[model samples]
Target: MWKVVVESKNQEQIRHLVFVDGINGRIRLHFDMVETSLRRKVYDNYNNPALGLPGYGPVRVEGGAATGVRDVDLAYEYMGDFYYFFKNNFNRDSYDGRGAELVATVRYCESYDDCPYDNDFWSSTKRQIVLGDGTVTDDCVGHELGHAVTDYTAGLCYFMQSGAINESYSDIWGEFIDLTNGKGNDSSSYRWYLFEDDKYGASRNMANPNIFEQPQRMTDYYYYCGIGDNGGVHINSGVGNKAAYLITDGGYFNGYSVRGLGLTKAAQIYYETLTHLLVSGSDYLDLYHALYQACMNLIGRFGITQNDCENVRYATLATEMNRTSTYCVYPKAPICDVGEPVDIFYDDVEGKEYWKLTPVTMLVLPKYLYSSEYARSGKYSLYGENLDVLSDFAISMKKGVSLPVGSALYFHFEHAYDFESEGSTMYDGGIVEYSIDGGRTWYDAGPMIINNGYDGVIYTGAGNPLSGRYAYTGTSFGFTSSRLNISSLAGRNVKFRFRIGNDEAYADDGWYIDNVRIYMCQVKIVDLTGYWVSVKQTCGRTSRCTIKGKFVVQNTGTSNSSAFKIRFYLSNDTIFSSDDLFLKEYSIKSLKSNTSKAISFNVKLTSGLNAAMRHVIAVVDADNVVNETNENNNLLPSVPFL
Candidate 1:
C-alpha cells in the first residue's frame, strides 16, 4: 500500500513506512527494523493481530531505504491494527467517546508534568496513552487501558483497598482476555504478572507479605510517587490480592504458600463476585457472602458444599478475623411505627381521653423524662401524664413512625417535681391507687400509700430535700404495701386518684410526681413439661434453659419493668427456695444503659422438688426490685407481680 503522511520529517534516512489514513489527517504506523523485530508465531486467540505485544515500540534508525536515525519527533509507530483501532475508535478532539481521531500523533513522554493525566485521566475527555516504550503490551494495554474503561464506564473505582484494586480487577480481565484472545505472554501470571515486575512486590509475596513491602506498604499511601495510573489504587490492595491469590489456590493459608488451581479459577470467582455481586470495596463479610452466593449460583449450593468441588470453600474471611456467629440473626427491625389513632382507648371509651381523672394524684409528664438510647429518634414517651391530653408526648419507635410491639413502657422518676402540690401535713386521707380495669376500679398502688396520717410528699422525707433541680424533698421513700404493682394486672388500662383533702387542714402540699414509663419486653420461655433446659443469661454470666417440651415464655404481666432483672426460674433442677417455691438463689441479669436486664440469661431449676406441681418460683434481688420497700426503704419481699 502507498504511504499516508500527516507531519513527516524529510530526513533521507528511512523508506517504506506503514501509513494509516484518517479523515482530515494521514499518519504512518512505522515498522522500523531491518532485522524485523516482530515475532511470527501461530497465536491461538490471545496474540495481537498486528504486531506482537509491545516489548519495545520504536527504535532509532541510522540510514537506509529503510534505516537512518532522524530526529523524528514521534515514537515508534504503533501496530497498524492498533493504530487503526485508535483511529477508528477514538478519533476526536472535543467529541466524548465516539469516533477515534483522538490525537493527531502518538508520542512518548517520561514525566507526568509534561503529560495531561490530571486533565483527562479520570475525566470523560480523551482516551490516549503515551506509554514509555518499556511499558507496552496487549496485557499491559488492557490493564492500564482498562482504567480508562472504568473511568469512563463506571465512576472512578474510588474505594481502592489499594490503588491497585482497579489494576488488580482489570488485570484479571486483561490477563484472561489476552489469554483468551491469544495475546497473552506465557510468563503472564495474573497474581504475578511478573513480566512487568510486582509494584508492591513485598505484599505480592503471595506466600508471605510481612516482606517485599516497599512499594506494597499499604500501611501508608505514598509509595507510588506520581504513577497515578490506577490513581494509586493498587497501594492498599495487598490484603485483597492475597485474598484473590489464596482464593485461586483454594485460599488455604496453611502456613505461607498458597495451594490450588491458579489464576484462571481465581479470575472467574473474583470477576463474578465483583461485577454482578459486590459493591466495590465491599467488606470481607459482604465478600464472603457474595463469594458463597456466587459459587452456589454457578454450581448449586449442594454441589459446591458437597463432594462436587474438592476444596470445599468454607470462606476464610470469618475465620481470618476469628469471629463466631450465633444462629440466624436478622438486623434489628424497627419495632414501632406511627399508626392511626395513636392513643390507647380505655374500656372502649368513645374518643374520651381520660375516663376518670384523679385529683390528689398529679398528672405531669415526667419533666425528668429520660431520652433512652433506643427512644431518642422519635417522640417515644413511655408514659406521659398529659399524654392522654397532649399530642406532643411521644414514644421512641424503631419503626420511626411506628411503635414497638410487646415493648415495655416506662418513665423515669429522675429526681422529682411538684405537679400541683400544696404541702400541708395533717393527712387528709390522700391515697394513690391504681386500676388495671380501664380506670374503672382503683387499688392501692403500694402500702406506702398514705391515709389518715402522713402528709403529701412522695420521695420527700427527712434528711434530704429535692436536690439541685428537684422539686421538693424526700430523696427516697418506701411502700408499706405493694406501691404500684401492675405486673399481675397487665394489659389493663390504669389510673390513679387522690383524696388528700376536700379543703381540710390535712393534705396541703398537693404532690410530687413523675409520669409512669412503659417498656415492652418479650421473654423467650422454654416449656419444661417434664424435663428442663439451661439458662446462661446472667450479669454477663453464661446460663442455659433446659425444658421438657415447648412452652411459651410470654410477657407474663405488664411489659414495663425497672431496676435490675425481675424473673423466675422453672428448672427441673433443685430449688434454692426456703419458703413456698422461691428460688433462694437469685437469677439476675445486668443492665447496660437502661433499667432493663443488663445480661438476661436463664437457669434450670428442678421438678425433683415438686415435679408434679410445676412450681415456677420468683427470684428478686436484695435491693429494690419489683419487691416494694417500706417508707423506711425496708424490703417488702413480695412477689414482683402482685
Candidate 2:
C-alpha cells in the first residue's frame, strides 16, 4: 500500500488530506495550484524595544519544491543573532552604525544559470548579503554581516595582508557570535570551528588552522605568496585567526605564553582596532600596533586592565605578526640627509627596486619590460622591446619622492633607444610623463628637459599610441645622459614613468634606461651658535643692577650670512620663550661660514629685574630675516649669570 499526505495552514483555515492507493498498490500525487505566505515582524533601525510588529507578508512561490525554507529560516534567525550581539556588546545600531537596513537574499543563483550556487559573499557595491543553499549557518551569517561592519568602518582593502586581516575579522566575529549567541553549540569541542554545523563540514579551525591547510604563523612554509586567491586572502588569514584565538583562550604556542582574557575583552580590543585604529592599507605589523593601542585605549574603561595588553603583545608575537620579512612590506618614504645630494630614488634595474612594468597591449606573450644586460653604468638596465606589432609598454616608479624644501631638485638618467623612423618623422618611440597627484593624472615632462632633449615627435599616424607627442625616437648611437630641471616640483611628492609604443607595421630595439636618480643640489644653511663668556653685575644707586657680559657668535653653515642682529634674554630655563625678559639687542656684521665673532655688552637692568634668578640665553637671526637650512640650531644652549 502507498500513502500520500498533504497539510496546509492559515489564520482562517487549516486542512489535511490523506490518500492510500488500494488498486495495484501504487499511488500518484498531483497539485493544480499551491500557495504559501510568510508574515514576519519588521523592526525600526534602532530596534529599540527588542520586539517588532507584524508587517511583511506573502512570499511568492512558483512550481519548485520548497526545500529552501529551512535555509531561509536559519538565515533570519542567525541574522537576528548577529544584530543582538553587536547591539548589546558594542552599542552599534546596525552594520553602518546609522541603522542601515539589513538585506539578505538566500538560495542565490546567478542569472541565466541553473547550477546550485555554493558560495556566500557580501556585495559591497550593492550593500547586501547573498547566500547559497545550505550555507546559512550561524557563523556564515555572522561572517557576511561582519564584512558590512568593516565596510562602514576600517574599509580594509581586500588584498595582501590587509585583505587577510579583513577575512580574519569576519571569521573572528562569526565564531564569537556563534559561541555567545545562546542558540548555537557553545561547547568547548565545537567552539573554535567555523561552519561546524553546515553540511559541508568544518571550513576552518580558528584554534588550529593548520589542519585545513592554513598558515598559523607568518614563517610557516604554507604562507602563500602566489598571485592566487587575491594574494592569498583566504589562506593567509589563518595567521590572524590564530592570533585572535590565542588572545581569547590563551595558550603556549610558538614559544609565547598568553593569558586568556576571555571573549568579551578580546572582542572589545579587536573591535576598537578594526573600527578606530586601522586604515585601509594596514598590514600585519600595523595590526599588531593597532591591537596594542586599542588595548591601551580601553584601559580605565570597559574593565580592561594592563595585563590584558601584555597578552595581546604575546599573542601577536606567537603568531609572528610583527615580522615583515615574510611578506611584501609596505613602502616607506626614503630618508634624506639635511644638505647632502642624496639619491632620493635610483633604479639600476639589476633587480626590482621601485619601478613597476605594465603592458598596455596583449599582442605578445610574457609581455614584461625586463632588466637586461644592456647596461649604461650597472650590470643590468630596464629594457623594453617591441616583440609584436602594435605593442605598448611602460615602466613607472611605484613610489613617489617628497622633494626636499629649500633645495633645487633634478631628475637624472642615462638611456638609449632605437625606433622605426623615416626621415624626420618617427613612427615608434618613447616618452616621459609624471604625476603629482599619486598617479591619477600624468603630464608630459618633455617641456622640463634641460639636457639631451627629445629627438623628435612621433608621427601622428601608423597606429602608434604615442603619436603626435615629442619623444625619444631614433637611435642615440650610445647611451646618453639626460637631465631635467624639476625644481618646480620641490616640496611636492611626484612619480615618473617611461612609456614606449610601436606601430602595426614595423618594430625595432625599443629602449634601455639605467642609473636613474632624483637628486638635489648641495643645500647651504647659515647655522649660527652663541655663548656667553663673562657676566658681571654691579648694583646701582636706585636698587638697579648694571650687567656686563661678553657674547660670541659663530656661523657653522656652508654659506656666508648677511648682517644679522642677535638678541639676549634672561630666562629661568635653558630654552628661550616669549615670556622671558629681554635684556639687550646687539648688531653683528656679516660673518663668513665657519667664522666666529665676539663682542662686549654693557646694559643696566631695571630695578625690578633680578639677575641672580635667571640664566642668559642668546639667539642669532632672531627675526628670521635670513634663510637657513637648520633654523633650529640658531639658539645658544644657555649660560648662568653667576
Candidate 3:
C-alpha cells in the first residue's frame, strides 16, 4: 500500500514520519526540519496577519488530512531522503496505483549556507544532499528533481560529459515541464522571457543559451554560477547545453546544421549517449569517442553519414585534447575538475580558522572573436588581499557606457559558514559593501545580513553603489554588497573593494565568498572577433630561442569594428632562473568576418638566451597565457633536458 506521509520530529535531527494517501493519488512529502537554517530559521508555523501567510520562514508542504488544511506548521524534509526512498524502496513493481512513498529529511547543517537549494553535498548519500540554505532558485527544485530522474532513468551512474548533457537534459525537460504544467510558457514564450514572476523563474532556453550569459560560449541555463552545489554542475553544464541548443536549432556561428536536431531527436541522442556511451569526466576527446557511438546507435541499421557528426568533428578540432600515454604525469592533477583554479589563503587571528576561499572568473566576449573584446574593453582588473584571506570569489561585473537614472544589477551569492561545531560565528562582516567612487567610499546596497545563503543581495548602483555585498562583521552585519552598477560608471575607471574595514581580508577563521559579481546598467555591445594571424615556429640562435618562436604569437584578427589589439607577451622559464623574462605587448586591430587574420608577434631572446628552453604557446589573449605576475598552482620547475 502506498501513502502520503507527514510526521513531526525534534526538528534538530533527521527523522522519517511516513503516512499513506490512497484517496488522492498525491505523493505527500514531509520531514523534521532542523532549527538551523541557511540564513533564517523556521520559528514555527503560526498563522500571520501581515500577509496572512503562515510562518516567518519557508514551510513544509501541507497535505490533505495528512498534516492539515493550514499552510504554516512548517516541517523538515530534504531532497536526499526522497531520492533515497525512491531509489532504494520506491519501485514500479511495488506500486499499487496509490500515492508514491517518497521519504525525505530537512536541512541538517552545512559548512556553507549556499543558495536556497544549494546543497554542499558534504558527501553524496542516498539520503540527503546536506544543503545550508543557499539561494536555491525555484528552477533548482526541478533541477534537483531532474537529478532524481536521471538517478533512476539513467541508472544513476554519473556520466561525465554526459553529466553536463544530463544537466542540460534536466534544465530542458524541467523547463518544459514547468511550461507544460502552467508554471511557465512554452515555445510561444521567448527563451529570453521570464515565466515565473517574483519567484525563481524559468529553467532553460532551447533557442539561445547565450541569453543572460556571462561569457560568449555559455548559456543562461548554467554558467558562472557560485560553486555551492555539487562542484558547479549547473555552471559547467552550458558546454553540453550549447550542444543541445545547436542540436535542436542550428548554431549562431558554429557553422553547422543544428536545424534538424529537434527535441525528440536531441532527447533520443542524449539519452543514448548518457546511459550507454560516456563515462564520468570523459574529457573532450572522450566525448568525441562517446558521441560517435551515440550517433551510430541512434541511426541503427538504417544508415548514418559524416554530415550527421559534423558537430562532433568540430568539437575534436577545437579540443585542448592533451592526453598522456599513461595517466601518470609528474604531480598528478585530478582527472575531473571545474574551471581554472586560484588558491585562496585564510589566516586565523581570533583563535578561529577560515578554512578555504576559492575564486572563479567568468568573462564573456563576442562569439568566435576574442582579441577584439580584449582590446576594446581595455579590460584590466585590480584585486588585493591575496596575502592570506578567506575572501575569494569569482567576481562577475558588467560594463555599460549608458544608463538612465535607474538600472538594475544583481550578484549571485551564498554564505559558506555553519560555525557552531567549529566554535565560530560564521565570521563577521556578514555584509558586502560596494563603492561607486572608485573605491574611495563604499555604501551597502545589497541584502541585509543573514547566516544562510538564501539571502542573495540585489543592489542597484542606480544612483548608489550597486548590487554588492560580503561579510563585514558576523553579528552586527549580514552581508556587504560587493556588486556595483556600471551606467555612468562604465569605462570610467571604477574601483571596487569587496571586503570591508576591520576584518581580515582572507583570514583562516572567516567566511568564503563565491560567485561575486558586478553588472552593467544597460546592455552594451561586445565583440571578440580575432584569431591567430598565423603560427610561426622558429629556432632562434639558442635551442630555447626555437622554443620561444614555437610559443610566440604571429597573426591575429583582421581589423574591423570588432578590433583586436595584439599585445604579445613572453615569459622566462625562470621559476628559479637567474634573471626575469617579461613578454611585451603590441596591437593589431583588423577583424573581418570569416577569416583568420595574420597577426605577427615576435619573441625576444633575453640575454639569458637559448639554454633554458622550457615550453611555448601563443593564444588570442592573456587569460589562457600564464607568466610571472600571474600565480598559477600548476606551474612547475623547468624539467632539465635529458
Candidate 4:
C-alpha cells in the first residue's frame, strides 16, 4: 500500500511519499526535515525582533507515494540526480563513499536580510546538507552536495586560499553536472551562469567574472586581510571558476589562450585532480600542479592526446598563479613521481665567502641590487653595474660537492637586465661562464636565456651623462638559469661566473641577482608486497570465508625511508597505479634499510575468494618523500593465488 504523509513545522508543513509493505509492515523511501531555527536556538541562543523573522524548529515529513509538493519533490529529485552522478559516473558509493545517509533540511530560517535570507550550506558537524526555500535551485543543490564530495576526498580547508579552491571546486562540479545532463544548453544564458532562480540573480558567472565584480586573474586578486568571510573565499574563487570555463569551452584572457576540449574531458581532469592531487592546505599554484598531474594521467588512462594535455596546461597558466615557477632538471617533474631534491648550497648575498666581485678600472658596481631593506630576500642580493666602455667585470662562485650518478645540477636564481637592444650580437648583455681554475680562465656556459620577457622594473642608466640619448631597451626578466650539467665537473671544485661588458658605449641597468641555489638528486628505494590468507571451515555444510589481509612495504635502499607515506589500494579490476580505489595511507617513520612494515585493512567475501582475480597494490613513498632510482617499480601488486 502507498500513502502520503504530512508533518508539521512552525505554522507550516511539508509532505513526501513512500511505500509500505502490506504484510511486512515495512516502510520504503523517507524524506526527513529538520527545523534549523530550533537547532540553532538550542545550540546557539534564540534572538529574534532586532533584524528579522520568527524562531525556527525541526520537523520530519513522510508519505507512502508521490505528494506533488514542489520544494520537497525538487530536493528529492536533485539529491537523487547528484547521487547518480557520482555513483554512475565516477564509481563513488556516496558522499562519504561508505553508504552515508543523505540528510537535508529544507526551510532553514530566512531571517538575516543581507543576501540569502534564503541560504544553504553543507554542515560538516551535522554530516548533512541543508537548503533554504529561496535558494532551492538545481545548481545550488548540486553545489552544496559538491561540498560533501570534497569533504570526503581532498578535505580542503575552509579558510584562506585553500578555502577558495574548495568553493571553486564545488562550483565546477555544479556546472559540469548541469552541462553533462543537458540542462545548461542555453548557449548565452546558462553556460557560465549559476543559481538563476535564486532571490538574487546568478551569484557567479564562470566565463566572465567582471560583470560580477570578481577578479578572474591572479593580478586582479582580492585578498581580504580582515577577519570576515573566511578571507573572501567566495570572492577569490573566481580565479579557479574562470579556469574551469576555459578548460571546458576555450577562451582568451589576460594575454593567455587555451583550447577548449569540451566538458567531458575537462570533467575527467578535474575529478582526478580533486580526488588524487589535492590535500587540505593546497593553494592556487598547487592546483596547477594537480591539474597537470591529472592531464598526464589522462594520457595513460583515457587515451588523451598531446593536444588535450596542452589545453589543460594553458587553462591553468591563465590563472596567473604561476607567479613563482622554477625550471627543474626535468620540465615534466610535477607530472610524475619525481626524485627528491637535495640542496647543495643557497646564497642570497647574505654571506660573502663563496662569491667574489672583480671590478675593472672604470668601476664595476657589484653589490646588493637594492638596499638590504628592499631586497627580494630581505637581505642583500648580488648586483653588478659596469657602465664603462670596454670594461670587464665578473662575480664568481666556487664550491665543491659530491654529485651522485644520474643527478643534474639545478641552478635557480632570479635576475633583471637591460642592455643594448640594437645589434644582432649585443656585447652589452651578460654571459654565464664556467671556470675550473678559480678565476684565471673561464669557458662561456651560455647566454642567460629569458623565455618569458621580464615583467618587473627595467632600469636604464638615464641619470649618467655617458648614458645620454642612449637607453639600452633590452631587458631579460627574472628567470632560472638552464640546468647546467655538472656531471663532468662532479667530485671536483666547480666555479661559475656572470660577466657583462660592452665594446664601446655601455648603457645597462645592471644585473640584480638573488635567491641563488643549486640542487642535486637524492635516491630512495622501497619494496612493496601484499597477501591474504583464508582458513577452511570444519563441517561439510560450511561456506568458505576469506580473511581481511595486509600489505607490506620495506625500505630496501642504502638510506632510510624518512617518514614517507605508503598507500594500499584494493581493486577487482585492472589496477592502474594511482587511478584505482584508494584504501588507506600509512606514514612510515624512518624505516632503516632492509626494514619492513605491514598495514592491515578490512575486507570480506561471501564466498571463497579468487585471489588471482582480485589485486592489492602497495605504493611506497607515495608522495615522493625520497627520489628513487626507478619510479615505475614503486607500485607492487599481490601475486595471483596459486
Candidate 5:
C-alpha cells in the first residue's frame, strides 16, 4: 500500500527521499545537508555552550534534538537574544559578567500531582530557571533570565519597594527583548504588552498598567500595600514599568512631559542603574537617583545628549519614583498655630507614642525596657537595657514627622544613662540617629548636636557593635537636657531613633529618655503687608482698556517669608471680599524679614463696570500656604485708575 525511497551520497549527507501511497500518490522530500549542518554547527557553538544542562528531547539529532522541543527552543532562543543584547549594548559578558552558563529546566513541575505547572520562576536557591508549560512565552523566558541578571547585579532584596523594583527590572528587560528580537510582533500596540504571544493573551501593559489593575504612578489609588506577593512586588512593579515605557516612547504623564530615547539608549541607562548605582536596600527614590546618575554618566558616550538626561528625569517624575514616602501614603504635617512657637513633633512617652523597638540581632533578651520608674517631666520614660551581651538595638518613632519650611528647628530631649565603662574607656553606650527616608536608613546626629554633645567614643576593642562611634556614655547623675539644631533637615519628612550597643562583658542600669520634642524657637510667621498699588491704563482702538499695576509687599515677621501668591480684584470699595471680581494672580519668591518685593500685573477690563468708579485691590498670600502673623493686613488699599 505504501513505498519508501531514499537517495544519499553518504551517511552524513542525505539528499532526497520519496514516499508513495497507493491512494494519495507520491510525496517528495528535499533535504539540504549544507544548511542543516550549518544550523547544527551554529547551535553547537553558540546556544549549546550557554546552557548548563541538556534540554528535554526525543532524540531527533545529536545536539539538534534539544532544539527541536518547542519550549526548550524558545528558552534557548530568548536566552541567546538577551545575551547578545547585553553583550553588544553594555559590554557585559553574561548575567554574571563572567560568561557563566545559563541554567534552565523546561516543563518544570513541583510534583506529579502538580504536573504542567502554570508559572515560571527564577529559583533563588538553585540560581536557575524553572519554566512552566502554560507561561513559557518569549517575554516570560526573558523575564526569568532577567531575574538571574538582577541576582548577579543589584541583588535587590525581594520585599517591599526593593522587591517591586526587582520585578520591574525583569519586566523592562523582557519587554525590551520582545520588541527588538526581530520575531513575533513588535508593533506599537503589542510592543508594550508583556506575554502578548502567550496563549492567554497579554498579562500586563507597561504603557498603562491600570488596564491590569496595577499602579502606573506611585500615588495611584490601586497601589497595593498588602503582605502577599512579597509586599505587592508584582502590583507595584507597574510604576517602574510605566517609567521604562515612557523613557523609551515619550509621553505626558502625571504632569510631566518626557521625550523618548530609543531602545538602546534607554536600555543603557537601566543597565548602568542595575549594575552600578543600586544596592540591596535601594527603593524607588534610590532608583530615581540611580537613573539620574546613569544618565549623567552616559552623557558623552553612545551619542547621549543632555536632552536624554532631562527626559530620564521627566520619566522618573512622571512615575513618581522621586517620592520618598511609601506608595499611596501621603503624610501631611499639622498646620502650625498662629502667634506661638510651632512644636513640629512631641512625645512625652506617656502612652500616646508610636515608637517601635527593633533588635539588630537574634538575641533573646528584651532590649526595650519602657517603664514608669524614670521620668524627666512625665510619669513614664523609654528605657533600654545594657544587659544584653554583644547586642545592638534601637527604638524609633514609627511615623515620620515633617519639618516645616522657613524656620530653624531643634531636637530637644532629656536622657540619663548608666553605661558600663572602664577608666576613660566606654564599653556600652547609646547614640541618636535620624532617617530622612522613613526609617529605611539612619545617619548619625552627632554633627547636628549643639548642646550636651556626645560624652565620649565607645571603646573599639571591647567587641561592641557600635565601637569607635561617639555616643552618650557614663553616668549623667540625673536627667540632662540635650539639644540639637536640626535646621538643615527642614522641609523633609524625618524619623528619629535612639540606638544602644553593648559589649560582651559588664552590665549596667541602662539608659532612660523622656520629654522628646522637635520645636522651632522662633515662629517663622509671614506677615505679608501690601504697601501700595499704583495703577495705569492702556486703551486700544476697540474701546477695550488694559489696566496695569505694581504692588509692593513687605515681610514684617521675625523670620524670612517663603514664596507666596498675590491676587488682584476689582471692587466698588477699598475692602477686598470674596464677592469682588477677580482679575489676575502673580507669584512672589521668598523675601527676607524686613524686606520688600514689588510685583507687576496686567488685567484687561472685560466686564461692563463703570471705569471711573471701579477700584483695584491687591491681596497677598491669597492661597494661605504661608502662616502669617497678621492675616488681616495682607490687603492693599484699593486705588483708582489714573
Candidate 6:
C-alpha cells in the first residue's frame, strides 16, 4: 500500500522522480524550496526554451530544490536583490513601478556547453529576463533589469543619441545596483568599471571614457555616419556614462566642474529625468537640457541650491552638449567664391578693363604710396568733392552680372570720408545703391560712410551733423566694410552704384572709396586658447600644503571671448567631480582680442589628508564658457602630491 500523507499549507512542496525502466526503482529527483514572501519566479530553461515546458504554477516553484539548480538559484537571488533595490531606494515595487511578478529564464539555448551565444538581456516584448549559461553576475543582471526599467519609462529610441543615453542609463543602474548589493569595493566609495569580472576585466570604465576610445566630449563625438552598431549607440554611450560619473563623483569634465550629489540623489535625479523629462528621440543636447531642468527641480523641491544647478550646467558643458554660450560666435557659411576684382578707380592698373564709369564730376585721389599710407591695398582712390553746392554725383559698374540662385553677393571695399556740420542739412550722407535693372529707377542702398567719421551725421536723427571724418581720422586712417550680404538680388542681373553728395552750407575732404570688390562672406569663428595651470608653492608646509596655481587664458581667434571659467581642484581621480576633497571656481569677466589673463588660486589641505597621494587639476573654460577651437588642452593635472 502507498503512504497517503496530506501536507500542511505552510510547507508547500514540489516532487519529481528519476526512474529506470522496471529494472531500477523510482527515486525522488527534485523538490521545491519555496519562499512565499518573494514575488519573483526563476526558471531553468534547461538549455532549451521555457515556453510550453511541462508543469507550471510558478516555473521556479516547479520540481526543483535549492540544491540542484545552481544557475536558477543564482538568478533567483539576484532578481530578489534587484526588487529590493528599487523598492527600498526608489519606493517602488518592480521595474514597472507596480508589484509585478518578476520572471527570469536561465540556462537558455540548446546546450549550455555547446551554445555559441554568451549574453543576457531584458526583453520588454517577452516581459522577462533571459540569460545564457555562465553569463550571470550582479552587473549583468542589473543591466538587463535596467533595460526593463527604461522600457517602462522614457521609451528611449534605440538609435543615435537616444540610444546612447539608454545604454548609459543601463550601465549606471547596473553599477548602482552592483555597488548597493554588497558586490563592489566600498573603500573607494565608487566602482567605475561595469561587468568587471564577467567580461574578463572591466567592460566599461565610467571614470574615464578613453579606455575604450569613446569620446568624452562633443568636440570628440563619434559620427559613425554609415549604418552600423545602431549609429554607434554603444560606442558613444561613454559620453553620457562619463556625465553620470561626474554627477555622482564630482569633478571636472570637458571644462565644467560637477558637484558630487552622491549616488542616492544622483539616482533620484536620473530617475526623474528618465521618467518625467526625457522623450523618445532626445539627443545629447536634449539630455543636457533635461538634466539642467532636473537639477533646478531638485533645488525647488529639495533645497539643493543654485550652485548645484550651476554644477549640472558645467557637467553638461564638459560633455560639449550644452548649446548655450553667450560668447560663442557662429559665422555664416559662404555661398560664393572670390570673383574677379572689380576696381572702380582704375586702382589695380588693370581696372580699366572691367570698369566704365559715367560721373557728373569726379576726381582721382592718389594716396601717398609710402608704406605708412592707409590706402586700401592700392595707390588710387575715388574722391568726390563738390565745392559749389549740393550736386548729384555717381559711380556705377558699367556691366551687370548674373548671381546664381541661393547664392550671396558680398561687397568688400575700403573708404574714408570727412563731413562738415551744417544746421540746414537734414541728412548729410553718401549712399551705396544697387540696381537689378540697367540704371533705371534707383534705390538708395544707404550710406557709404566708413569710420573716417561721416556715419554719425547720417545716423543721428534729423538735424544733428558731424564735422569729422566718417571713419578714422588723419591720412593714416582707413576703413574696410564687412562682407555685405546681397542675397536679395540673387538670381537677378545686378550692378552696384556709389553716390556721395555735399550740402551747400560747407564742404570737406569728400568720400574716398577704393579697392572695391565683391566676393563670398568668409565664416567668422572664435579660437579660445590658454587656461594652462602652472603650480607653485604659495605658502604653508608639506602635509598641510598650500599650493598656488595660475590659469592662463587667451583669445587666439578673430572673435573675442566675452566670458570664461577656470576651475581648479585637488583630487585622486583623473576626472573632476563634486565629491573631490578640494575645489575652487573662477571666471574671466571679459577676455578681449589677442590677450591673456593669469588667474591665480590657492589650495590648502590640512585635515583629512591622504598623506600618500593627490592630484592638482585645473580646467580652463570648464563650462565651455565660450566656444573654442581646441578643447583637448584645457585639462592640466600636476604631479601627484603627498
lDDT of 6 by residue, 1-642 (tens): 122233455323323233333434444243333332347677666665434222122456423556457667777777777877777666566888766777787767644465633767787777888877666677778888888887787777565556778888988888888878885343452377776746344667788877777767655644233225655677778888888888888997655667887787778778888888875545676689888888788775545667876776777788777542122112222223533222222233124344444443334222322121223332345544423354445666777767666434556555544444344332344557678887775665544322122234342443222222142222211233333566566677777766654444445545556556654343334566564456654334445656666667677766566677777777676676777654688877877767777777776756545424567677777788666667677776765654
Tell me the tens digit of each residue's lDDT in model 5 across 386-482: 8747888887888999998877788888776778986788999999999999888899999998777788899999789889999998665434567
Instruction: Report each candidate's C-alpha RMSD, comma-separated, in the order given.
Output: 25.9, 18.7, 23.7, 20.3, 18.6, 28.6
Tens digits of lDDT, candidate 3, 143-196: 454564554444322322234445655565444333333332334654423223
On TM-score, the stronger of 1 and 2 is 2
Whole-model lDDT per candidate = 0.31, 0.75, 0.34, 0.60, 0.75, 0.61
- TM-scores of the models, in the given order? 0.33, 0.51, 0.31, 0.44, 0.49, 0.44
Give the residue spans of candidate 1 off by over 4 A. 1-130, 148-156, 160-164, 177-185, 188-191, 194-232, 250-264, 300-642
The true-structure Cα RMSD of candidate 3 reads 23.7
Which candidate ranks first by TM-score, i.e. highest? 2
In angstroms, how far off is 478's CA in candidate 6?
49
**How many collisions per candidate?**
118, 0, 100, 11, 0, 23
Model 4 Cα RMSD, Å? 20.3
lDDT of 4 by residue, 415-501 (tens): 545465444334355656676665567766643222222222212342222232222224542212234445565654556776655
- Candidate 1 accuracy as TM-score: 0.33
Ten consecutive residues with minimal summed lDDT in candidate 1?
Answer: 474-483
Prediction 3 global C-alpha lDDT: 0.34
- lDDT (0-100) at residue 19 of candidate 5? 51
Better candidate number, 4 or 6, judged by TM-score? 4
Could you arrange the candidates by TM-score from highest to lowest?
2, 5, 4, 6, 1, 3
Report the candidate with higher TM-score, 2 versus 6: 2
Error of 6 at 481 (Å): 34
Candidate 4 segments whose C-alpha is farther than 4 A from its true place: 1-64, 110-116, 182-187, 221-227, 324-642
In candidate 2, which residue ranges exceed 4 Å CA deviation?
Answer: 1-68, 110-116, 325-642
